[model samples]
Target: MTFEIAFVLLSLLGMVIALILDKMRPGMVLFSVVVLFLCAGILTPKEMLEGFSNKGMITVAMLFLVSEGVRQSGALGQVIKKLLPEGKTTVFKAQFRMLPSIAFISAFLNNTPVVVIFAPIIKRWAQSVHLPATKFLIPLSYVTILGGICTLIGTSTNLVVHGMILEAGYEGFTMFELGKVGIFIAIAGIIYLFLFSKKLLPDARPDTAVPDEEVEDGEKLHRVEAVLGARFPGINKTLADFNFQRHYGAEVKEIKTRNGQRFVTNLNQIVLREGDTLVVMADDTFIPTWGESSVFMMLANGKDTEPVPGKKKRWFALILLILMIVGATVGELPVTKEMFPNIKLDMFFFVCVTTIIMAWTKIFPARKYTKYISWDILITIACAFAISKAMVNSGVADGVAHYIIGLSHNYGPHVLLAILFVITNLFTELITNNAAAALAFPLALALSQQLGVDPTPFFVVICMAASASFSTPIGYQTNLIVQGIGNYKFMDFVRIGLPLNIITFLISVFLIPLIWPF
Candidate 1:
């Protein structure tokens, strides 16, 4: 074993342990590993920090602002209201009418905002139509995830993989290149939900429905949901033992586990886990005080998450988004290249222009633009690039790839591709999709090189696998968002999502290679 290989192995082991121990953010863990490599003379200062300035990373940052603009503009809400058929009265009919449209819209928009805007609307509408909201909510999240895989910018994971591709000196994905296989997955997923979902999905999660009573002034009681993080020192203790109300000045109504199990009536019996989410009723000050606290991994209340844009501004924001998509798509054409030989036109150019215009127009409170960006995610992605490089530099990626090839030699690249898909999907389920893609990309590239085949199929599989997270609410952000709002149980996700996961696996393994010709 060479010194570089040994050092890389130790660094990877330490990272896994640190992440599993839940002590540090992924960015911090990866950055610390890079520091070790730098100190040991394994990598130079420039190479170690190059990811911070990476074009793909910066593009992701810019897209955050762009998505924020659309979210705040209220265009998504208007579109959903218009698109949902007025006469749909049953869960099955409503799903048939809505899921495909949601999937199509989600292919063009960010999944979180789409879920945030649509989840409440769907729940209210389901109640009005005498349907089970639990039926449509999980499908809402699942379809958005499926739709997001169709476009390069649909999920941050896609862009992260694209960034890795560019960093590895490969051609990056085009605007709709992923649609080739992604559309099939989305269509199949929608069919599955339409046919089999009503039987499997839960009818209700206890205490998920909002309380009906309002104040004399017609204002709703402020109900906030928060998850305990490192800041709260009361892990593994009951609420009675911990004195919940005295410390936080809030009344805990229910506790939702990470897997979506809810303890609605018993607040004192169940012990608290660090990531356990408590649905509490408190005054308006709860969000203001604990919003930025490290004690809460998440703090969410309704309606105040983003400001609603007026009708005119909403239309303007929608137009800006459409132009960005169109410009980016058209810019990739040969005719456009011929027309503008000296200048470049791509998704990056359009996204940059859109973000700047939205900021200037104050589409989403330009003064606090940085607040909208998830700094933790950006940091994680930047560091992930460096970590992938370290693996390649130390030969760790190639070594692992060869071992897998040695074991699966008889079945050839098809088996290796399937293994990659399964591994990447499991990682996405356990960690963030962007992190999963980053960790899997280096090995995928190494495996392709070993087999002397096109890496396109491998890259496509990674893109699909990382975004195909199901079977758990924690797997995807959209799933988590809907889980709380819909009052879902853990088994609800497992029953419906497990089938979808299997479907995604089969389609990706069989369909991706056909399109990319590995």
Candidate 2:
């Protein structure tokens, strides 16, 4: 009822709108909120900037680098090629084999990279075997998410939460601590995908085995092709300069340079050049306009070709990635810890070293490899920490926690634990997993203080629930990656994921108290 409270609520509402619209990136949205609060004198400058220094933020950045190293080393690609079946396998057997393996790999590697490396391969294999790619992609993304919950270093979400816990003066999670619930969740998930997924999953598009080269044939939108001519005013200009929506009312889907560089059209700063091919989605009205423009040499009707990394670069990238994983594991051991107390062998350290080494080795030509890293994701994570700090410092999280405990007063600890698991899981589905953990963490601490019990079990629940992002594709980056490549509709994920979500929720509720003992 207080005006200040109302303002904070309004600010949070703004954040929700931003997330739903998704027109602006999450980082920009969170950052805008921070600035609004700061201007309102709700948060100090120190508080606004504090997230930048948080261990959680740093760990996420490091994980991205480590993932890049693995990607550059070509380790993931090789593994996918080896593990994926070639032909003549039953759909059930293939799903069982592929989902679990991908899940396990995602436990250590970044889930996004795992999906990216495997998506095309799975698509190709699905075509060759006369199976639907849609059937497997959602399962692939879901299983990886399930597997990421299994280890301390499995996903950046865990590390971020662990770092936040350490900052709260509690000892952070140990390696495999989450495995208590995570393993069961993974098992349950694998079971759901293996047994019921085929029945529930939609085969929206038949297995046409459209080669990466032939993705154009399946294009549903109106296609406009523009050839870059020498006098093209747009040449060397970024897409932003073209004012694409203003000038053509058409969205650029893909850009292909003469050199074979190809990518989704959202890349804003890529300079347009002569003799380049642009795959644009527009109405027929714009085609004549595009033809009249001097910027383009000609218009064509076809899908853009997929860019293939060099064979030598792919192999080297794979080897280097394997080395990063092995090295990070070795570096994190008790012996290694004792040898170098000052140097922590965490995701950040591993990623930094691996990125540097991969760049030096020119595994994927360091320059291009650098571009592969999702800078937006890193910024989003850092801003998420700031928002979390704001929530805690503003006493909002504690107030929410008090309200929750008041409601659960007569419900007992088991009921309270289940409630916490459900709340965390729902939050994770709505927001970034790391953001979910950050928001829930302060509540966990507050609840423990009120209940006069150990906070370990509560923290464990948050970690497990935060990483259980199975209900929606948009909730997790890996899911989005697979959704596009697998050509799956939104409901395909929910059909298979809803059961796995329930399974994980039940498993976490039962196991947390027994394992960590609140």
Candidate 3:
């Protein structure tokens, strides 16, 4: 390899290590690598900053606001409650009723918000029906992931790939184009979960550190579940230093970490991290006080602490979401494209309109709009573009692609596709999915060019492999949220998600070529 290629490769290795070791936030780690590329003359300043103005990254930012509007309307929380049957039910029955709807909902809204809203409700419902919360939490996370693959806006990674494709002088994906393969994958994966998840998942019960008894002031202590977001002030600090009770007027009863450890004693010694679920004991005002705060991605009452939102607001928010989806889908039609040649009525356009309408209508708190957007994720995606560009600029992707082609040429493109899928999937399971896609995109592009085929199939595989993050909590943010709230061990995911990962791998390898011809 040339020195520039060697340097890019080594920098990527260090970036992945930093991400996996939790040396810093993922956005910072990725941004650092992009900066390194700029300093090494692999990228110009404009090239490095191109990602910040990417269409996909901007769409992702808007979707976060739309999701926040829906979340604040309290419609989803109510819908989840209705989805769960009240009477006695089997795990199969409960999953059948719950998982599919959630999958569909997540296809339009961001899956992170879907999980943030649904997890606590499902956990509470599971307890009510005398079922294991652990049995359902992982399934909830997995199904959302499956659903996200079905649409362009379903997951940020899809949009990220689309943005990269556009940047590469190809047509971007339509709203439902991914659904062709994504639907089958979702069906097969959901069926697998329905059949085996119950047997594979653990039966851990919820552990309440403090009882719901009355205190000296004749006030009842309420249990509140808070899933820490990237903005949590206490992240990386111990309770002794942060003083959780003094700051929030709530006592940290316990902390459930993504590593699958639950700390009920000596909690002051443990360092906090994003995606950690805190079981807190507070007064009646806790949920109302911190419900809309950005520090916690989600805050659900352990009991019914607040009244459900009005039917009107729920319907309005739902309608707005539907309009955003349909408008984007129809605008991409050839007829519409011809009608509005100068104005592309794509996801970006519709999302911008929807967010502004919601803001004016007071769907979500408009003033605190910054709280809704996860800037870290946005930064990560923007830097991902720059990183991918550096790979292409330095010829690292060509070098690696030729090496892989040499190994698999004897076996033909099928083996090559499988190998690429495996490599991308391994990176996703170890680090962030967006980073994984950025890392693999250039190689996929080079592979298609060397083989003299359309890069569409290779691109599809990257999307599938990148988003199909299973077998580890750290791979996806949703998994981390579930791991903490479900109080599961790392082995719990390995036991259950590993098979699903293989299923996704098999489906992507066998089906993508059929859908998007190589």
Top of the candidates by lDDT? 3
lDDT digits (tens) for residues 1-518 of candidate 1: 89998998898778767765556666777778888988887778888888888877888888878887988887777777776657646667778778998998888777876886787777667666667788888899999998899998888888899989998899999999999999999999999999999999878654565463465777555777776754467776789899888988877888887666788887799888655778887776777777645566556665444345689999889899899999999999999999999878988899999999999998877888877676777888888888888888889899989999999999989999999999999888876787788779999999999999999999999999999988887777778777766778777888899899999999999998888998
**lDDT, candidate 3, 1-518, per-residue tens:** 68998999899999999988887889999999999999999999999999999989999999999998998888888889889989899999999999899999989988987888788888888888899998899999999999999999989999999999999999989999999999998999999989998888887665755677688989998777788888788889999899888889988888888787888999999999888889898888888888777888777775653336788988999999999999999999999999999998999999999999999999987899998898999999999999999999999999999999998779888888999899999999999999999999999999999999999988988988999988999899899888877888899989988998899889888988898887
Per-candidate clash tally? 0, 10, 0
| TM-score of each model, paired residue for residue | 0.89, 0.78, 0.97
Error of 1 at 492 (Å): 2.2
Name the TM-score of candidate 1: 0.89
Whole-structure CA lDDT of model 2? 0.70
Judging by TM-score, tell me the better candidate of 1 and 3.
3
Clashing pairs in 2: 66-351, 72-317, 73-317, 73-318, 74-317, 74-318, 75-318, 227-297, 232-295, 236-272
lDDT of 2 by residue, 1-518 (tens): 45555676688777777666554556677778878878877788887776678776676665666666666555676777678777698889888678778888888777866775677677777777888877887787788888899987788778877777777788777667788788988888888788898889877563222222323556345655555544456666788787666766767776665433565735677776544556666655665555434444345433212224667766666666567667666876789999999988854576677667766876545555444555555666666666666676677777777888888899767777778788878877876676677667777888887888898988888888888877776677667555544545667667778778788878888888888876
lDDT of 1: 0.83
Runs with alpha carbons beyond 4 Å of true place in candidate 2: 1-4, 207-336, 368-370
